[model samples]
Target: MNLTLASGAPRPSQTFRTVFPVLALCWLAVFFDGMDVNIYGAVMPHMLDDSGLGLTPASAGTIGSWTTFGMLIGALTAGNLTDWLGRRLMLVASVTLFSVGSAVCAVAGGVALFGFGRFVSGLGLGGLMPLCLAMVMEFAPPRRAALTTGLLMTSYHFGGMAATGLGLTLAQAAGWRWVFWAGVLPAVIAVPLLLKLLPESPGVLLARGEREKADAV
Candidate 1:
């Protein structure tokens, strides 16, 4: 069956199921990206108070700049790498990079190490958004592509709010390190599902001359 309406647009129900694996996984990844990005801000007050770390206002700003610099580098490089590597692998790698970065932050004892962790996480955070955007757009129903993109973008805000909630609750309770530990959840939770369920991009496959594989997807 065509599984579409008279206008030749796929029904929302059908379209959703067809793309759900990719869309859902991408949404989850982007959500983590947002959370990781904002978590620093959320935990800043607590971090400043921790005298052992020696975090000053000037140094904090410098670390923030390092993160943004890393993000800029990551964003610029990801597109080139994606062309050679494909979206699925790149997305997985990006998630792993950020999660590992979070772990580093969780264990960091000083300003230098913490700043490095943020920079590392920033690389993955920068790379992830474009990849997720590309994946969802590729899989979304034609007529509803804009809506799907909008929906995917909203997850970032939700993730940010979640970070704030965690800052208020978790950071206040267990400590800021534990909150960053929570940032590692995406690697543990989403990675296995993404590897098993997410399909490779058909367009990328075709571009790489895997026409049969592309067709199968």
Candidate 2:
């Protein structure tokens, strides 16, 4: 069955009507991805101040590097996996992995645990960026692809702003743990919505030879 346009027209021009919702969803997910990615930096000062973490300046820097390293691995592996797994599943998995990492940070007893949590989260975090970009790019109309790419990138800044806002407001009142807990909120909110609403990438379906399914979009 063919998808109807929002105006109830039978899929007309393969223009904004087909693309806007997909872009919006990817934009929001990328926004949260940005927020989650930056939350560590935003809370670093508080983490250092806690004293309980026993994080020296040198070690702190090393931990940051480790998290980045984790992200690098995650990105590479997830990119390859996306071809086999499909975009929607990878996005959901990425969100879930990071959310669990946030929770792990919330209850972490030491720097090691916190760093490990960040690393685990990084794996999911790294995968999300390219996946979202690719999905949006593939689905966006030819003339609009570049514009959509820019739009998706903008969500990173928006997510960073949100993380900064949370750090300023919640970290002061409730403690850094609360900030991490807040990070988990995206998993709760975004994961279900993504699984339920985000459409499968048509390219992915077409590659799997599910032409009927792809055209149904």
Candidate 3:
């Protein structure tokens, strides 16, 4: 079905063909976002047990706050950056930032370093969800926008569950650091796919007066 804007120009309603690629990629990114976010909580107990890291309950809480603070900063800035950088770059950067942050956490020798890592990851985590939601909404059928958003959010929970499962198995077997290493997987897995397959947002193209590019998208 074609939709008509207020200008009476017909806008193409994206079918599953166009929608699925964006949806799947966005979903996978969100899944990793969720996994990375929850992995901290899942492995917190083990972190506290490890004496060398010096993670006390009070410091742990403070580190968590740092993560939240970084998230606030990232969330506030990401939308503005999206206008200039576009969704694909933002997504790629966000994932890479978090993955690199996770690697930092994996190697962190002390509390300060670990907290800094969490904060860095928080920035990426905050940016990723909104970018993904916006991307998916742009491509979804108008009538199905809410449904697609709902579907995208489900990956987050699944990812959290996966984090829990990893905490249960990998943390116990290898160590908490290994769980953080696992957090790096999203960048390794999603970045290549997103760069290859995800289309640029047509709305963004149009906003930039690149109507021909927008139409191609």
Candidate 4:
């Protein structure tokens, strides 16, 4: 039986109504960000085994730092641009940029190229979390906002686990490049829905003087 709370909200079974459509889309977007973050780690051993690439442990660490560095810059930059570009557009751009980076890594012929790809992917990965969290908080019912945020965050860990699973099962059989190629899947899966359904942040609209649009959103 459906249960009711003292505050008049339904129990867990009925909390689905508290979730907005954008929550699912943002969750998917964040999932890919996690996967892209870990894809290189998942396939690093295999990549290192190839003699032609000449990836020493020292160099690998440096390359890994590049990704992290890109993310640092991306987060700071995206944070400032949130007001100007709006959440939905920035989120789409972040996903698309990383997917393109993953594609570049998938086709790269050498260590330098792969490192560059990782850096590019990191840039997008960095910016997606704040955007996703902002959207989730904006849409969640006031009473359940905290729970919805926690749920959204779990998707990141799950995405990382999925990357590890893919590496264990398919990286060797399909090749390392295939692992990076898989990173592009999020753009294909999430971009269309986000473009069609995700709404801009009300705060952003109000800041830009679109009071009517902000109220409607």
Root-mean-square deviation of Cα positions for candidate 1 versus the true structure, in angstroms: 2.5
Q: Report every candidate's CA lDDT.
A: 0.89, 0.85, 0.92, 0.85
Give the alpha carbon lDDT tens digit for every residue of 101-206 in model 4.
Answer: 9999998888899889889998898899988998888767667788889989998998899899878878989888888888888789888888998888887888
TM per prediction: 0.93, 0.91, 0.94, 0.90
Backbone clashes per model, in order? 0, 0, 0, 0
Indicate the worst ten consecutive residues by lDDT in candidate 2.
1-10
Clashing pairs in 3: none
Candidate 3, residue 130: lDDT: 90
Please write out the lDDT profile of model 3 over residues 119-195, one tens digit for every residue. 99999999999999999998887778999999999999999999999999999999999999999998789999999
lDDT of 1 by residue, 23-73 (tens): 889998899999989999999899999999989999999999988988888
The alpha-carbon deviation from the true structure for residue 75 of candidate 4, after best TM-score superposition, in angstroms, is 0.8
In model 1, state the lDDT of residue 190.
Answer: 75
* Stretches > 4 Å off in candidate 1: 1-14
Off by over 4 Å in 4: 1-18
Better of 1 and 2 by lDDT: 1
TM-score of model number 3:
0.94
What is the clash count of model 3? 0
CA deviation > 4 Å runs, candidate 2: 1-14
